[model samples]
Target: MNGAPSTVWFDRKRIAPNVPEDLESIDPMCEEIGKVIQLEVDQGIPRNKIIVGGFSMGGCLALHVAYRFQQEIAGVFALSSFLNDNSKVYKDLASSDCRRPPLFQCHGKVDPLVLYEWGESTKDLLIKAGVMCQFHSYPRLYHEMNKDELDKLQAWIDQTLTSS
Candidate 1:
């Protein structure tokens, strides 16, 4: 499997409408991912075989893109991430008729950077939107993935790939 890493920077004050900003950055990031998906399609790969995932900011991006992409994808894997803008995301999800794939979200309970509550809230949002989400929380972990998280992630991937 090939992995792609992308970086984007934005001023927090400029983006924040409320406590949580409407992340306009997701738009360009999704466009970039869309191009990558198109490239895979051009190379004869089916869209359903493509799983979009990431850690932290990347994970947030993955969820935003997958939920709004207008196509059914394999699955989404998010670690230590949360929704950027709840109202916008909910609206997008509610209006879409595309097949919503399963989501696996892993978070560290003691994470200082991205609070554990944020992760749980994100999972709750997805679940309320009628999306299937598997959420795992680690007791003393903080802002990083552990071995147990990796194992669970692997199982989720295996199950998702096999069932799909």
Candidate 2:
């Protein structure tokens, strides 16, 4: 500890051992999300009302599941994250029955772990595939969320939930 604030961390090595090559290792997480979604549906929640999102690795998984999920959901929120498997996402987007939920992806310009270019690439890719994605970049920000991001996220959640 270098006297910095403690933060939540995901074990990327264990989650995606091959990094840029083998993103399939995270597929199990998407399966778990499916189970949770099933449970939510069984409990009387409509699938379209469910919004999936997270930060960092969790955000990556959220994108993966939302893109590949058979049912259309409310939206996807990914913060300080990038697509785990660009090829897989492209393939999924090519499907005729693919879900095209609105996506809100926010990243920091100064993010050291996940470069800004990666996040931009993700937004561009999704847009090219005809997905509605709102991308926000914070100047001088790091690999974390700030008040502005939170405020925007809150507004997005409110609007999406009410409109849908």
Candidate 3:
């Protein structure tokens, strides 16, 4: 992760979604990111050794890729991010028997762009669907991430990826 990011950034030049989420827009991007994950597998890397996550809209895409791909990874985290109601990730995890890795979701209590309530709702949905989520909230934080959360997230990553 330090030197190999394996990033897949889709151009954000398309029309905005008419609804809460436009699967049409999201699917293609997820497909490309999925390709990256698959490539890792093809290269003999175990799926459980990979970790995928993002911030804001990128976080939303990461969730889609993780659940749609439906394989175990080291972990996932969503920072100041939220998922639309009835997100397919919920549906997929609810129906699948895969062993999902722990999730490390964090949000600011005062975030305006992605509301704190929205973040909470996303956590609720994921938990309700039986996903293991470690949700964190900052009292005076905003839409951006901070050192505290990053430190905690890094620790979580180390623990999750450690060979136990």
The RMSD of every model to the true structure, in order and in angstroms, is 5.4, 4.6, 6.3
Across 41-122, the per-residue lDDT of candidate 3 in tens digits comes to: 9999888888889998888788877777735777788898877776778778888887666789999999877888888898
Off by more than 4 A, model 1: 1-23, 85-87
**Which tens-of-lDDT digit does each residue in 7-87 have in candidate 1?**
442224322223654457657778888899889989998888888999987887788778887347899999988775544
Residue pairs with clashing backbones, model 3: none
Q: Pick the candidate with the highest TM-score.
A: 1
The regions of model 3 sitting more than 4 angstroms off are 1-18
Using all chains and alpha carbons, the TM-scores for the candidates as numbered come to 0.86, 0.84, 0.84
Q: Score candidate 2 by lDDT.
A: 0.78
Candidate 2 residue-wise lDDT, 51-98, digit = tens: 899998778778778888634789999998877443576677877566
Q: What is the alpha-carbon RMSD of candidate 2 to the true structure?
A: 4.6
What 10-residue stretch in candidate 2 is worst by lDDT? 9-18
lDDT score, candidate 3: 0.79
Alpha-carbon RMSD, candidate 1: 5.4
Better-scoring candidate (lDDT), 2 or 3: 3
